[model samples]
Target: MSTDEHLDPIPDSFILQPPVFHPVIPYGTTIFGGLYAGKMVTLQGVVPLHARRFQVDFQCGCCLHPQPDVAFRFSPRFYTVKPHVICNTHQGGLWQKEIRWPGVALQRGDSFLILFLFENEEVKVSVNGQHFLHYRYRLPLSRVDTLDISGDILVKAVGFLNINPFLLYSPRLEVPCSRALPRGLWPGQVIVVRGLVLKEPKDFTLSLKDGTTHVPVTLRASFTDRTLAWVSSWGRKKLISAPFLFHPQRFFEVLLLCQEGGLKLALNGQGLGATSLDQKALEQLRELRISGNVHLYCVHC
Candidate 1:
């Protein structure tokens, strides 16, 4: 997909589950870590003008002959006289009682959004933001791991939104992104940045700034000096010396943990070092700015 199509801007305040873009029809893929209560699945697509029917199946597995048990089958039939939606489950190679909701809200030849929200007891479905129906679980939700979609629909994107506090995930985020720190910097909070260094790298910096636009803390990864430097309003305290991990064409994750003393730093998952900051200064921070030679993937606050 083109960069423009993939990096559609979303507000930084709310974290999102990474979305799948421009997938081919009859698509089937394993859910990242499987579904759980409070999780949601979103599908964006257009129904073919002459489409007869289409179905989205949440299956235990993509087995063929034995026909893996289907946790949920969401089908929209355009071939019907009045048009309607069908919900059902398949287990032991038998189809369960059909649940029908008449009067389909979807229109052919137009874009649509389908949301499947998983709850502890049932799956709530919404069509283009309107609540449509609910289906109670027959098979264990834990057994559902694969998503299979087929039929006459022009699929655009499919996204999974996992519930997490102060976290966000985007398959791809535009570089030079700045996000707000709504709760400000506080003890016991963590900010994570994941990205790839440009092939021909230059200095890249992640900075925390106050509402007044004054930067209080900044971490710079310099290729020329091959060092990671921590700088703040006080001074450039020290540099993370030799064998720096931020290299050209390499993937890296930088984590900053706010603590009582200051901030704990980590490169990838390993401890890099720590920096001390006055609680007053950390509390004043309101935004995070990232710039220079990096392609961002996800950012969590």
Candidate 2:
């Protein structure tokens, strides 16, 4: 899949997370107003250690009723003939020719994130942030009213995010700045920062702090120390190699995903940030400050 298939960072509205369905096998749920172009469904979970097979289906009607039409069936098998994943359509309870994709990206006892983004002609699927498959619409997209996932897997979260709206694509902003997060620092929300390092810079810091007092959680990338560091008052500060040393003048983007435990950080796709962001941090997190020697371009929280 092309990078264009991925959802944009600046969102007019956020994803709507539905309640997780645990131990869901042969389980199904209604897709409100039916599925459509520009609608996206995301699933995150773990593949059981002893997993045999799993299937996620988008259907006009579920198998609970007879003769249900399955628009898209994503069935991945582990102990199958060749251990491959198949994509197919089932109409009038009859199956179509299967399209096979090799390589089982999900191993036993591993977690995975799956995203299905619908477009006019096809549904783009990505597994663990990597493009997995794309299925052209043999049946009308609007006919898909229910989503069903069955077989061996542990379900954690299922959510929907709309990409049809014209969310304000916040252009670049000035650096050495303190800016408010788009929707405040809430769990499930994401913060995206884009910028370039200054030539011969010693360091730069990105801090998220409370509105009033400056009790802050800072991520500092230092050339002098030759490390990318993380610091909060409580947890042990984490430091690693200084990529900025050779990356000066090169553009970069950082993404922060707020979770229950803490803020999970990523540069491009590499994991960063280490520390538990406690209740106090959530209650007070209000301002995002960027300082030091860097040219800030975009900050979309």
Candidate 3:
């Protein structure tokens, strides 16, 4: 996993948010779109200087009396002589056998970036860009909807980001890649492109085309002028111009969500709004072509 220096001070209105969060402890929020493989939960915060212990829980619900089931409980304790991390589940009001990892990676007063990558059968945890541990699922992952963080820690930001679009078998895909879309465009399907802009980027374009070499839609990110252009062939028109999101030598995740009307665009988890294209034009899209200044990491539809 690559780290982006620009990722900190996340965008104010991103799908992955609790942006500029209130410095209050015991933070809780709904995991928008729920838990799924390739989804990432990111938390940026610092451990309180006097912190004794803190826990992050993924729960099925937020019920009080009976207490909703906790699919995953990740707790780090400072009171212990070794300062270890405990991972377990709470089901039917009982705690399951715990798996303890001695020596917590996080230390008091240290600002940290924690990422939880959800996989089919487990969650991979990373702290400050280093692999921390893996916690296998004890309960059905689909049941997780809420994220709860309690105890002593200062939270800066939290984000629920989607990546790897359709779960490619290969970890990454090469740049200037082209793929055929046999079924054309379908509503609810998403196209995700993750990569790093070149040190001196010129521009990049992600386009959808038909067999006759006609491009129906193209999203062009221009570093020269720092603008994102939405191009369409329906009327040979440029739909709109959005603020350029890609930065030279920075990691970026671009998401294009197919909808009945058009595609919803998001950059690095921040929703950039949408554009409307004809459904008939979309249905004729048989190819996805990406080219220009980037080191591609992954691309899936």
Candidate 4:
């Protein structure tokens, strides 16, 4: 799998009992969930073209308002006097000096995903699948009961996942992967695919079907002489093509979010659509099957 496509399996603890996420919010919101040392928090959003700055913080309390001690703060500034990102801590009514990075890979008007994995000694952070920063433990994780996000970014989803030790040590599904869907489609159910597209490949198919009959949906990505993969859905012998393909073989993570309406697509963290379902075939969508040239590392539904 490509480095960009690499993502740790979200585990049963996360997918089945994920933290109550405020899926979509304005530029700011307050989250009230105390985090533990082994928990991971994930957030997805977009950076508008005119964005100047945005921040995410884990604080002592939400009701504490302005004076709560902030365990960690992640702020990315695009149009400030100096374009940079700041990582800092706040305590005793004062903010400490920040650890700053001068440049950023996030593009304006593009979607992004950020993950904060709390460890015993440090908070490891990743942005858009790439390691970004590491902040030493300054305040106790037990005191962090709230998450505050504010700035120009449009928030899409924010949630936390508890780590399970047994799952962590279990065997992983290697390449050429295929698996059965847990319980068919249900709202709030999410299927996550993490893998690398083959560097030199012709085509690949990621599929879902009813165990008794034909495939209800087949995600086919075909390449020609160029480096693009024509991504689309093939079902009931019909194909619907996306306008473009995400860069291949460089690491990719695709998430299929089942909602009341249908499927919400996110490729490498950027959301695509919540297209309505073709109920005839969708209602019976029962099994997940992957057979393609791509190297499938991890799949969780």
Candidate 5:
């Protein structure tokens, strides 16, 4: 017999159409079975713009799946909805809107992933591998333990899969106190930094060079209450205070990293100073802050 002849016929309950298939599982059917009761699970679906609502159906246990519980609904716009084991409605119609998935206006064949982390405090939803939504539960999970799927769309497939909560990557930052500044320095971002200063002279200056204009970057003493003030000069003749005294051979090098929120100062890879910065100063730093003295080389501030 031919493979087609031996294959089982599509179920009569499902409507198999070009866009919406019945005998075949729809592209957006909600799946709720196999380890989907109390643990978190990852949901994947292909959504066509016309699919209005997507629902998952599951069997509920009296003491396992509770009623009037909040579930985290995740998409581009995150939301919260209450789901029941038997039906979508609550005591009355109070949660009708909450239980129904609104039309997302997705394009045909648009695929997306929804991560539902059902925790004690809230149900966190991550979409497309990014953090998106959080929903608090009003009803306890002990009362309802079943899952169900229903909506104006078809679900291709649904499964309960394990996920690592902390498998995410972050970037590193570096900033110097006496050399050229790095790129991507903004008012709110943090920077890693390193530098030098003479203590004898009461007045010391540090200027971040940017093109033709030299912008003075603020420098605060990490150990003491003393603060250094600086001004940018037009020519090579930078101004210096005569009262400033320096140990003839006691030159120091420091690494200074900073963000608009705060700064950390290090010396030769060893930490020396750290402090929180004023919000106003961080917002005004349009140009990248460079290290080094004005007498050195010109930098792109």
Candidate 6:
């Protein structure tokens, strides 16, 4: 199927024009009409009011419902701005604003383009080819399955451009320590960690060392297909499928490691391309345990 065919269709609440209408509002007007539907579109217009706001709806397949994703607010303090695409879930509403180009001012005869790549979880908003904002959904955009555009602002020309899914682009990953294990992991703490698989199926063992007493904590591996198995501690185990290639380097998983530094990771001891600790304030080290459904095997630490 074509790329556009894979994305959600645009609703009919918008208009495209070369001679677009420009509304005149008072200096302090805050409310206005808006265009509320489309996957990928471009809008050009002049701001008659001193300030305005734009809202858009977004949904992911893995998520529950459509949520407000982006808002463009024009103000003196926030001039020439680009809003980030909000992914509702994952990493506490992942913000991919770093991938976007700096925003530009809105002026008469100036053109603006807002491109949404649903299949690839990316949004590019540009003003006159000068990239203003570019953002990517962090957690594989399983939540957003639909999109809607709406807002009230002076518009001169509006155009809808459907994109092919394969043509979608993702911004570079530059966050330092994007997938490091948590420092202080206490009881009842839910943490998620992702990292590249440097070594697959390495021995993952947890032992408690208390004065003359050492015990092995059972560790397991979970395969990618959701199968489970026990990993022998002293065996040369191959966790991932041999001949595994790590292209796209973004492969990782999240672990809900609880208190006592008890590891709750995929069976293969592999790292999820990314890791996130839902709660920031976890207590220091505690005893460790190993027992659970193995999710992934053959992973790098």
Residues 1-301 of candidate 4 have per-residue lDDT tens digits of 7886675554443332233343443333344336666667777778889998988888887654577899999889988665678989999889998899766667678787787888888999877767888889788887887777887788766655554343435454665576776567877878887555677777666677775856555666656632223233452333343333334654455678888766777654445555566554555687777666666656888
Which residue pairs overlap in candidate 1's backbone?
15-168
State the lDDT of candidate 1 residue by residue for 27-75, as single tens digits. Answer: 9988866766756787878999999889999999888889989999999
Give TM per candidate.
Answer: 0.54, 0.60, 0.56, 0.62, 0.31, 0.28
Candidate 1 worst ten-residue window by lDDT: 161-170
What C-alpha lDDT do the candidate models reach, one value each? 0.80, 0.72, 0.78, 0.67, 0.37, 0.33
lDDT, candidate 2, 171-228, per-residue tens:
4467688777534577788777766677877887888877674656788777785678
Kindly provide the TM-score of model 1 when superposed on the true structure, using C-alpha atoms. Answer: 0.54
Instruction: Count the clashes in each prediction.
Output: 1, 0, 0, 2, 54, 45
**Rank list by lDDT:** 1, 3, 2, 4, 5, 6
A best-first ranking of the candidates according to their TM-score comes to 4, 2, 3, 1, 5, 6
Better of 2 and 6 by TM-score: 2
Which structure is stronger by lDDT: 2 or 3?
Answer: 3
What ranges in model 4 sit over 4 Å off? 1-33, 106-111, 159-165, 171-206, 220-261, 265-272, 290-301
Worst lDDT run of 10 residues, candidate 5, spans 12-21
Q: Name the lDDT of candidate 5.
A: 0.37
| Residues 1-301 of candidate 6: C-alpha lDDT, one tens digit per residue | 8898976543332111111123332212111112222234444444334434443344332233442333322221123355232222223454334322223455423334333323344555544434555544454443343333334455443333322221123222332221322344556555432233323333223222222233222233333432222233344232433212121222333344454434443211222122222332233223333222222221212
lDDT of 3: 0.78
How displaced is residue 241 in candidate 3, in Å?
A: 28
Best by lDDT: 1
